[model samples]
Target: MKNSITPSVPARGPADHEVRDQIVAAATEHFSRYGYEKTTVSDLAKAIGFSKAYIYKFFESKQAIGEMICANCLQEIEREVRTAVAEADLPPEKLRRVFKVFTEASLKLFFRDRKLYDIAASAATENWQAVQAYEARVRTLLREVLQEGRQSGDFERKTPLDETATAIYLVLRPYLNPLLLQYNRDTTDVAPAQLSSLVLRSLSP
Candidate 1:
């Protein structure tokens, strides 16, 4: 039998980060239109005028690309949340506005672009570091709000800050979580304002 040799893959260079970003952007567009399950490395490469081999040089798999996209989306959400937190004065007001901003953004992003949301939700289950970091940032923001509320005599101090933040997250999860929001929309008739009021009441001093 004749011996066969595998061709060498291109080495990553200083430009790899830029190229990787380009690949991620193209992947985002394709995933948005066709969805994560349907979008493939081939589609991404073709869209970017590159080859599948080149894409593999930067990303190990399509899932990796999806993870990057999810991270980007979460980072965007975090920025919006931080802005909402900075602008509000009182803890209750901060909590309410933060919750409103997050829920509104979630609904707009998930419903308008469900495919990307689905990919993000799936990536979250795998506990990607980006997702974990984004989650931590949210928790910290919530804890800060709670601490401020306690100091200002706005929120009851019976519960620990961590516990209060956790409770608030859980209570509003159906609205914050993409999958849960989808389920809630399909299964129930409760409105976002109603849910907001219920959560705010629990935080009262």
Candidate 2:
């Protein structure tokens, strides 16, 4: 079912660790399949072949499991952003790379885990721990990249790192909306080279 779900968290570990991981894995699967409101503890437990009580011991509730799953997703997003930021050689280039990398990862995730994706998009407003941490981590990466750009005199906006990061988010945010998917399921609208050209032109002095 659904391409034979394979959980990222490993399976063979200490019994306790395996149980916890299995619960997380099961929750990820169910959430990816059914989303937040529809996914239930029993479904997760059955998916993992664990008793309901066993699941509770590892996670107090579905929301707890959700936070854990979101944390995992955030960690993944941070990794991708960090990679993109690390690879770029210039400020304008960094923004372009970050946008492309973030967009590709998001589109992949949006299809695989739409609810969690939405959860992250609204995390700033929802005040969810997972979302908060996720945004914080992304901001940290942005700051680091901008600091490098500052040394190179690449950023002329005089905006604080946080403001600039939010601005980037503003620029990239609309593409992640569900409606945008109808346009070639995450393609079209702006080809990478064109988007990069637009960003470079706007950001360059």
| CA-only RMSD, every prediction | 10.4, 7.1
- TM-score between candidate 1 and the true structure: 0.81
**Best-matching candidate per TM-score:** 1
Clashing pairs in 2: none
**Clashes, model 2:** 0
TM-score for predicted model 2 compared with the true structure = 0.71
Residue-wise C-alpha lDDT for candidate 1, range 99-175, written one tens digit per residue: 77777777776678877876877865677666666666677777888888889897888988898788777766777
lDDT of 2 at 149: 69
**lDDT computed for candidate 1:** 0.72
TM-score for all predictions?
Answer: 0.81, 0.71
Please provide, for model 2 over 77-165, each residue's C-alpha lDDT reduced to its tens digit, 9 standing for 90 to 100: 55776676666677777777766776777666656756655544444345666655555555556566666767777765566667876
| Top candidate by lDDT | 1
